[model samples]
Target: MIKWVAAFLGYFIFRFPGAVLGFIVGSLFDNMGGSNGGGRNVFQDLTRQSVSPADFELNLLSLCSIVIKADGQVSQRELDYVRQYFLSTYGKEKANAIFRTFNDVIKKREVSAQRICSYLVQRTRYEVRLQLLHFLFGIAQADGQVSKAEVIKLRELAGYLRVGQHDFESIMAMFIKSADNAYKILEIEKTVSDDEVKKAYRTMAKKYHPDRVVTENEAIKKGAEEKFKEVQKAYEIIQKERGIS
Candidate 1:
C-alpha cells in the first residue's frame, strides 16, 4: 500500500530512480507496522528483529525512572514499587541484575520518551502498551497520591507511545479517584443513554479482557486482569447508579 503510493509519487516527480528509492523507504514503513494487515496479532511476529528481552527490560526501567523523577523529588516508595514489580515478574536475581544495570547505566543517560516509546509503539501489541501505561500509573500512585508533574509526564509518554487519549484516561481513572471515574473507565460520557451505557460496558469488557493479551509472562497477563477487573467494577457502579440489571 504505502510502497506503491510512494512509488507512484516518486515516478510522478523524478521517474525511475526516485521510484526505486521511494519503494525502498515505503517498504521499511510497511515492515515496521503500517496499514497493511492492521488486525494482525502482534505476538504472531515474535521472531521478527524486535526489541530483545534485555532491551525491553532496560527501556521499561528508563520509563520508570522518568516517571519517578518527574515530580522533581524521587520517592522511595515509587522506587520500591518498581523494584518489587520487577522482582515478581523476573524473579529476584534477574530483577536485581536489571536494577544494577538501570542504576549504573540507563538511569544516568538522558532518556528520550519519544525515542524509546516510538520503538515500542511499532513492535509491541496494543494490549501490551496499555499494560505499560497501567504499570507507569501504578508507579506514580505508589506513594498514595499521584503528583501533577507525574501525571504530565505519564501523559507525555502515552502520547509518544501512540496510546489514544481515551484509553489513557481510562487507565488513569483506575488509579486516580474522581467523581466521574466510572464513566472515564468505561470510556464514555455521562450523557449517554442507558442502552449506550450497556453497550459501552460490553465494549470495555471485551477491550480489557484478560485473555486478550496472549503473552508468556504471567505478570503482563495479571496486569491485564487488573484492567479487566477495573472495567467490570466500573460497569457495576454505573449499573447501580442507573438501576440497570
Candidate 2:
C-alpha cells in the first residue's frame, strides 16, 4: 500500500521534496492504518522515525539469539524462556511457528552481538532497545544465575546498544539480587543517605515509568509496565529495610 502510493506520487507529483514528503507520509499512513478515519494518530508523526513493529520484533529476536549463545551452550530453560516470551507476546499457535522458524535462522547464522546491535542503536528508540536488553537479561538468568561470560557479553551488548551504565546496572539488578543489589536496582551508591535513597527512588520511578510508552503498541507498553514494576519492587524493598514510609 505504501509502495503503491509512493510510486503513484512519484509518477504524478514527480517533484523533489514534494515526492519525498509524499513517500514518507504515505509510509506513516500505512503504519497508522485506517483506524482513525484519516484522523491523527499519536504515532503517525513518529512512524517513520523508527523501524516498523514487525522489524522491531525481528531485530529483537536476532539479538536474543546472540545472547542465548553467549555461554557457549544453550540450555532448555533458556529456550523455554524464549518460547514463553513469544507465547505471551504473540499467541500459542503463532508463537510455536515463529519459534521454529526463528530457531532455524539463528542456528544457521553466526551473528556477533556488537555488529548487529551497533546497527540497531542508530535507528531504534532507547525504550525499545532497553526492552531488548531486558529480554536478554531474562534469558541469561533463566536457569538460575547469569554466567560470567554472559555478563561480559551482555555488558558489551549494553554498550553497543547505548544503554547507560546506570540503566544497565539497574536492569541487571532485577535479575541478579545480592546483598547490596538493591542499591544497584535504584541506580544509587550504598553510601548515600536515607534522603538520597528516597530521591533515587523517585528518580528511577520516573525514569522507568510505563506511561512513557503509553503511545507505543500494547506489547511494548506491557514491557515498560514490567520494568516499572521492577523499579517499584526494588524501592519497596529498600523502604522496608530503611524503615522509611
Candidate 3:
C-alpha cells in the first residue's frame, strides 16, 4: 500500500513538468529506496532533455534571421516590423532577448542556409513557422515593392520550411490583393484630378506602397500593379460618385 502511494505520486509529477525533472527527483527518492522502483526514471530523463533550448528558441531565431534577410537589404521598416511582431507575440522582455539572439545569428555572416533551415525544422511548430514566413512576405511588401532577390529568398524559405509551392503562390496573391484594397480605401488615382487626388495619391501611395512598408525592391513591381489598378478604380469610383468625370 505504501509503495502504491509513492508510485502514484511519481506518476503525477511526471505528467506536468514531464519525465526529466521527475526522473531526477524520482531517482533521488529511488536511491533512498522510498517507493515503486525506477520504472519512470528513464522516461523522466528523456523528457527533461527534450525540453532544452534546441527544441524551440534556437530554431525560431534562425528562421527569423533568414526572413529578415529575404530581401537583399534589410530596411528600417523591416526591422521595425520584426520588432513590433516580437514584442506583440512574445511580450517586451522576451522579445528583446529574441531580437538580440536573432541579430547575433544574422550578423555572423557565415551561417549556411541549410544550417539555418535545419534549426527551424527542429524547433518551430508548423503554424508558428507559417506565421514567420508570412511576416517575411509582409516585410517584402512593406517597401511597396518586392525585389527578384527577395522573391527568390522567400521561395527558398518556403521550400525549406516544407510549405507547398501552391501555398506560397497563394500567399503572394494575398499580398497583392491587400495592396489593391488599401488603394481603394484611400480613394487615390492613377492620374491627377485636382490637387486632392495628387495629394491623396501621394499620401495613399506612401501608405500602401511596398517601399514604405519595407525597403524598395524591383520584384515588388508586380505587386504594385495591383495597387495601380486599385488607384485607377478608386479614381473612377470617386469621379463617378462626385460627378467629376
lDDT of 2 by residue, 1-245 (tens): 88567856775776666667777878877866743332222222223254554555566677778778888887889889988877876689878877886687568557666767876776657876677788789899998889998999899999998999999999998888799888898999888899999999889888778776646456566767888888888878888988988
Q: On a 0 to 1 TM-score scale, where does candidate 3 land against the true structure?
A: 0.47
Better of 1 and 3 by TM-score: 1
Clashing pairs in 1: none
Worst 10 residues of 2 by lDDT: 39-48
Alpha carbon lDDT of each predicted model: 0.82, 0.76, 0.56
- Which number leads on lDDT? 1
Report the Cα lDDT for residue 100, model 2: 82
| 15-38 per-residue lDDT for model 1 (tens digits) | 999899889988988886643332
* lDDT string, candidate 3, 1-245, tens digits: 33444555666876544544555665666554443233221111112123344335565556556666766466777677767766755579877987887778777665566766665566444433444566678777776777677888788888887766644654555465553443334543334356675477556546445443221222333344454455556556655655763
- If ranked by TM-score, best first, what sequence of candidates would result? 1, 2, 3
Clashes of 1: 0
* TM values, all candidates: 0.79, 0.75, 0.47
Candidate scoring better on lDDT of 1 and 2: 1
Q: Quantify how close model 2 is to the true structure by its C-alpha RMSD in Å.
A: 7.2
